[model samples]
Each structure stands twice: as C-alpha cells, then as structure tokens.
Target chain A: MIVIGSESRGSVPNTSPNVRDMAQVSCCQLDEEEFRKCCLQLLQRSEELRDGWSWQQPQGSEDGYLKKTTLRCVSVTSKRSKKNQQDSALLIDSDCRQNQSAHVSAAPEEATDDADDEDVADDADVPACSACESSFLQFEYHVVFSCSYSSPVLYFRAFTLEGRSLTLEEVWSSIHPNFRLHLQENPLNAVSQQEHPLLGQPFFLLHPCRTEEFMKPLLQMAQQHHRSVNYVLSWLSIIGPVVGLHVPLQYFSTVCVKDPASSSNPG
Target chain B: MIMNNDKDVLRDVWFGRIPSCFTLNSDEVTEREAEPYYLMLPRVSYLTLVTDKVKKHFLKAMRTDEVEEMWFEYEGTPLKWHYPIGVLFDLHASASALPWSIIVHFKSFPDRDLLHCPTNSVIEAHFMSSIKEADVLKHKSQVVNDMQKKDHKQLWMGLQNDKFDQFWAMNRKLMEYSTEEGGFRYIPFRIYQTTGDKPFIQKLFRPVSPQGNPHTLCDLLKEMYPAALTNDGEQKRYQVLIHGIEPLLETPLQWLSEHLSHPDNFLHICIVPVPTD
Candidate 1:
C-alpha cells in the first residue's frame, strides 16, 4: 500500500513539468558545498525564512563538516472558523472520547472553545467567530543534511503556548487536513520522533530514506528544462507546507531571475 | 580459515557484555533501602530494552506515587537510552573500574539530556530507522528497500530477543556487495569523542580508495578525525575503540564494519583519552 502511494506521489511532479515560466533549476542531490550555497540563497531570497532560520555550526565540529539550519518558535495557527468548526469539533470530540485522560489536559481550550463561544458572544460587541478561538502551536524546525541520502532532512518539535511539548497525536491534529491525509497515506515517511543527530534531543523528523526517491523526478524535470533551481527552496516548497512551514511564493519569484554564473555551471 | 576468522569476530562482537550495578538514587523516598541490582548488559542492546528487571527491582522499594519514569545516570551524565549500551559505556565510562556503577533515578527525569523510552516499540522504531539510514549509506538503500517487512522484523526481534543466528541470517544480505565495487559504497560510521559537546561525527567515507586500495581504520581517522591518531615516536593520547577493543589501525574498514557493527549496522567508534596509569 505504501509503495503504491509513494510511487503516485513521486509521479505528481513529473506530470507538471511546466510549473512556472520561471527558469528554476533543481539538483538530483546536493553535496555539502551545494547544501551550504543553497541555504545562503534561501536566506537571502526569503526574508520571513531568514528571520526564523539560522545556520547553526555546532561547536567543536571541524571545518567543512555539515552544519544544520534551524528555525525556532514558528507559530502555526490552526483556525477552527465557523464554516469548518463543526468538522474540527467532531474530530476533537471523538479524540476526547477515545483518550479522555491523555488529550483533555493538552487541548482543554480547544475542547471547550465551542462551549465558551456563547459567553464570548454575549460579552463582546463584535460577532463571535471560531477564528477568535483558534489554537496556536509553535514549532522548531531544523534542516540538517543527511550524508547517507544526500538530502536535507527536516527535524521539528511542536510546543504549546504554555511550553509543553505536543505529543505525536496532538501534532497530527494540528496538521492541515489536506496534508494530514497525504502523510497518513505514506506512514513510513511520515513524521516520527527521533534523537536529533547533533543535539541528542528528541525531535520529530521526516525520514529521508525516500527523499531521494521522490525528489529525483522533480529535479530531473527542472534540469531538463535548463532551469537553475535552488535544491533547498524547491524541496522545502514541497515538504514545508505539510508541517506548516509555508515557503512564500515571493521566494520562487525572486530566485527565478537566473544568475549567469550558476546557469553555466554543470550539474 | 578467513571465513572462520570472520565468523569468530562477528560472534565475539555480538557476545560482548558489560557487567553493571544499578543503585536507586539516594533522594528517592523508599520504604526500605533499595538493593543494588547487578546484571551483564549486552553491548549491542539498548539500555531501555534490557533493563526491565533492574526497574522492577528498584520499584519494589519505592511507593507508586514516589516513582516516575526510570532513568539511568553514570557519574554526572544521564545515559541516553537511544545509544547502544557499549557506545554509552565507551564514550562516558570506559576507564571506570569493573561493575560499572549506574544511578537509577525515579524522579526528576532529565528531559534535556535523555529521550523518554516509554515502551520497547520506541526502541524498535529507532532501531529500524537507524538500519534504514545505514543501508542508505551502504547500497543506496537498495538492499533494505527490497527487503520484506517480515525480514526487517526478524532482524529487530533477533536483537530484542538476543538471538545471534536469527539476526545474522537476515543481516548478511545487507552486508553484501559486488566484487567490482569491492566494498560498501560508503562505510556507515560515527566517530565519538568524549571531550567534545558534539554528539558524534558522521560524514560520507568510502571503504575503498579510488585507486582500489582498501581504506583502513587509520585512513578513516586521518581523514575525519586526525586528532585521534598519533605520529610516529609521539606519545599516544587517544585510544580508538570498537566493541571495547582497539583493533589495529591497519584493520580494513570494510572488515570491521562487517564484523564489529552493532545490530543497528553502524560502526560506532569511541576515541577516548588513554588512561595515564
């Protein structure tokens, strides 16, 4: 089942060869040097990404070793607006029913948000909307280069506003329903808590074993089109949305202006 | 004879054990003094997977309310259960005396230094992920990707149950390579050092040189960690240990990876300061 799902996911980029008129080149895989260069380009091109993400070279590591890019305290607001509040409420309601003790404390505000809406409506002049009762989650994401896969793996951890870490269930609930379905379809490559390679802290990471498998076709299309794509930007644009790290469309537009020097360089 | 030697090395690496004593922390409110538990820990196994008996023994002395998730500490450092038992020992307490003394804590779990191991499933997931990562380095993940889910389970269950024959039966496939390629595409290894705050050093390293010369342990150290090696006539400052023994620097990386790797299939080398005595 997973194999079929991954194959279909891999083919999505192949079908859409002409994503944009912009000349964006992508690499099949990145070496350490290319990863560093791409990270610089990502930060330079995108201001929002730059504010959150910083290159962290672990102390005591020798020069030329792989450095990680980290983005801390990124706020992802999952709004349960009036239109979709019923669906979301049902989801949370079922969750509470199944695991009453475990999830009640973690999502008390969310569980009671609907009930409190009446009181909030009576007290406030403005119309009470579910958006006002939206739950906010903060995520810390690290982009570390995997030498084995020759790709950047995303390691992240989500926390509540009160500083408690979210369990895997809570994290899944926070993901956008669309991306959640796709992630659920391919559970093997889905987010899992693992020890951080550099920090030794438990952080959730998307397994990179299949990254090269899915990325090859996407990169090849860009290469064949004679477009110069930033590997990190292209990869992140596809993956980041699944975990709420949306790469602004402006990043692509800015990077689309081809640099003459990089264009001439061979893959 | 060469094959026999290889088998013997693999057996020796698999059977390596560390004798340990687990004593409850002094501050815990116990009904009575907790008896120190002694056990021979399997070098390749994870601490969380094999220490249920130790947890049970210590829990008997303490009230249920007083107890929390159990954690282990050696000296001042909290032992990370995710690391192989041997790597933890060699990295932190290699020079310590026999019957490695470990403090068992029932309270104040160090969330910063340790990952919570609530169940064996966590260990299994971590163990499988590691093998998958290692395979990506070895054969571009071809061997592991082609494996049936049942085959993967056999490897994990073997390690969990301490069955050498069951593990090697499936693992031998992951270690194979074409004669033309000579060795694994890249040797999966992590060089650990005690002095650094860094977790470990991992990078792409080929088991064979471009000229078809096999890379030895010395060649790897020279490229990745030159500080671990000593110059001729210079005093040796560090010992390069695999499976708690210093194999000759001339030992081929391919052979060591094949025979000396833990169940997770990575060559875990600890570069510790040599004992002055």
Candidate 2:
C-alpha cells in the first residue's frame, strides 16, 4: 500500500474500524517494578494475615446483616471458584494467613523478598505453571475452594465472573452453604462465640490491589470505546500490521464480568 | 562518517560477513528475560541504501560533525546530538507505528571534518510501471506449476480455504468492477541491491512471505547475491539510487531525494582505484 516512513498524514488503507479505534486509545504504562511497589505499599497499610496475605477493615455489609472485609491476595490468587470449578480459587494455608497477619501488624518497612512465592507469567507466549519445566500448553488454571483437606467443596462461581455480572443467587449458589462471605475484613470475628459458627467454608478472596486507580481509568476507556479488555488485547495485537512495524506495550486490560452478585457487572 | 579511522578495513570486515548473531541481533537465548546482547552491545550492521536529493543534504550536514553537537528538537523537546544512541534507536523503533517524522531544519549545516564522500555506486532500479503486467504473467506460471505439483481436490481445497488468496490477490485487477477498468495501474518501485561500488537490480520483489518469516527476507537477499560482487569498469554502472519506489497515487518522492543528499548517512562503498602513499 506504499506505507512509507514514520509520518504520513492520511488514513491507513485496509485498516479495520475497530483496530483504528483501539490505536487512538491511550493506556497507562506499568512495568513489573512499579507493580511490585504498588503491591508492597498496599500490604503495609493493611493488617497482614500472613507472609504474603493481608486483610483490611471489615466494612458495612450490603444487606446490613452480612459484613464484608477485603482480602488482598499478594503474590497469591484467591481460589474464588465453585467446587466443580474449584481450580480457580485462592488456596491459602492457615499458617500462611497467620504469618501474613503478624507481618502486617508489625508495620515493617522492609518488604520481604519471599512474600508469596507465586510466579505470574505476563507473556502470552509463556503460560503460568506450578513448576518451571512444564510445557507452555501443559499449564492448567487452578481454582480456590473452601477449606477441605478431604472432599474439597468449591463455592466461588467461575462462570459468572467471566464478564463481571452475576445475580445474588448465582453468587449464593456458588458459595458453600456452611461458609458465608462476610463483607467484613476483620480476620478475628467479633461474633466467634455464636453457635453454628462459619469456619472452613471459603469466602471469595478478592484481590487487595484494587485501588480503582489502575482499573477505573481502564474501565472508562473500555466503556467510552465500547470494548472489552479482551477486545483491547486483541486490538493491540493487530498494531503490528498497521504501520508495517511491531510496537509492544506493557499495560493491558482483561475483559471481566462482575459477579452480578458483586454488582459491578460490565455487561 | 568519520566515527573511526580505517574505513577501508571496516568496509572489508562487513564484506566478509560476520554471523547474524554479531550483525543482525537475532540469536536465540535460553530464557527470554533480558536480551543481554541487544541491551548491552551495539548491533552494527551495514544498512545499505541508495540516496536521493534532500537526504544527501542531510547527510552532508551530518558529516560536517556539527549535527552531533547541535541541539535539535525531537517531539518538541530539545535533544542534543550526543544523547545516548539508545534513545534515538528506541524512538525511531516506536515511531515506526506512527507516521514518519518530518524534519524541518531551522539552522545551517555543521562545521566539522568533511569525511563524507558520495560514490557513483549503482542500486536496483525497480520500474514501478512494469510490475502489474509482470506479476500477472508470473502468477499464471505459478498457478500452472502448483497444479502440476498437486491434485485437483487439494488445489480446490487450498483455494476454498483462502490459502492461495494472497497470491491471487496480488496479481488480481484492483478496479475489476469499476467503470474505468485499469483505473489504478499497480506499479511497484524497482529495487536495486548495491555492494561496494557496483549496484545490481534485485530479481526478488517481495522479501517477506505472507506467513511472516523474517528469515525468508535474508534468504531472498542471499539468493540474489550468491557471490561477492566486485566494482570494476567491466561490471555494471548503475544509475541514481532511490528508496520507497512502490508506486501509489501520491509519491513521497521528496523522501528519496532528501536521503540522497547526505553522503554520510548513505555511504556509497566504492573500491579505491589507487593506493595513496
């Protein structure tokens, strides 16, 4: 098409409308180093439940009867999936959570190098795996279910989470009947002495890194553009052919469906 | 142009051809963590180009060695010539996606050593006017060859699956349904390959395949230059070297002319006729 040099002031020929729209959208550039610092700052501000995990104040409940707390899965992914879809949940050991709490309470300025030893592969070419030697295709998605060393019951629904919208029943059905997901963040339950106490049943471990600073703008971009994070990723991927060159960016968003149960439905 | 002494030796070293690892910066590493070689060392490869008019002026300015000291603005920010080489490389690489930067010089040429010299080396001359007709005939032969190579069912399946679409599309009529048949005659630039003093017309038009294999570009170039070419009176004396020749409705003819003016930027390698004492 005779696309020459860096600056030609015309519409690129053969360019799709969706691709051109994405090229115009701007995104925040976050490197691995910046991500690490943001994560560490969040951990220090909240109460650490263990080495890599932390909890914040259990806020007022949505229904007034159910209190909600925020769990920051640092270097850890909260197994937030149903039992059948249990591979997606965050599995935190009790000792790890206790250690996390102790560390958070200490108010240590020195961030530990070994806080939650989970490795997340940020590249599409490479897949995240438990072991380094596994093939790229061999890696499987894991889910976090409620505490069961035996018949592992999963409560977090994975399907509804895909586009970020779900009904209260969808969330309720996904949760184990024994464990109620309290909106409160206090690891120490004030009503621990109550009969038929909820223990071992896992609540969805929401990521603590959600300051809205990173996501709010991304959501705005997606909404204003009528696109999804998946759509953006797909859009960015096509930039190679546009100018007849390859340009890679660090920041990208994933199209997410909020648990209609959670009320942040993207759709 | 005079970054280092012994220009002849440097030219010869390039002519010998080092491995692609040392030259092009495309070696496979164990973990894709950091490209140590690309990050640390300068990947020096001979980017052979034929110059036009305006580019020749810029080259002359660069050779005066004053551009290296001049404080010029890039993207509105004033940057000096001696800023890290990485900065220029990075910006250019990223800017590849963006439109080409229009260089508007407000000042005069630099006052350094005049080491820059223009050679009368020949480069490939792709006559954009002839490509459409030639491509049509070439594809017809290719289709005949493919039929002989494969059975009827396989050929039908390949066509149905859009496998041969690019090949056919390249040779197809662009204005088939238009009232003005042959409204846009697809003419490609004549590409010339130059080595030392002599320039040769390139036989292969497209360096890359539709499947995106970069190695194929190298392979095509290698196939075109099977043996080392020496520049002598008996060999071919090529005409003016040009860049970005692919014929379109509007030609950025100035770009080629601008690049040709600068002798330093486009070093025309020519064998010395006499050994100076």
Quick one: best lDDT, which candidate? 1
Query: What TM-score would you give candidate 2 relative to the actual structure?
Result: 0.17
> What are the RMSDs of all candidates, in order?
10.7, 26.8
Per-residue CA lDDT of model 1 for A215-263, tens digit only, reads: 8988888879987788888888888767666667778886866342432
For A161-186, candidate 2 gives per-residue lDDT tens digits of 11122222333333232333442232
Write candidate 2's Cα lDDT for B1-277 as tens digits: 1123433433332222111111111221112222111112111211212112333334343323222211223344332222122223232222243232323232331212111112211011111112212322222112222233233333233223323433223222211211111111111122222222112222223322334322222243244442322345555332221221112212232222112211111112111122122
CAPRI category for model 2: incorrect
Binned by DockQ into CAPRI classes (incorrect, acceptable, medium, high), candidate 1 is incorrect
Q: What are the per-model DockQ values?
A: 0.19, 0.01
Error of 2 at B135 (Å): 33
Best-fitting candidate, scored by TM-score? 1
Clashes (N, CA, C under 3 Å) per candidate: 3, 78
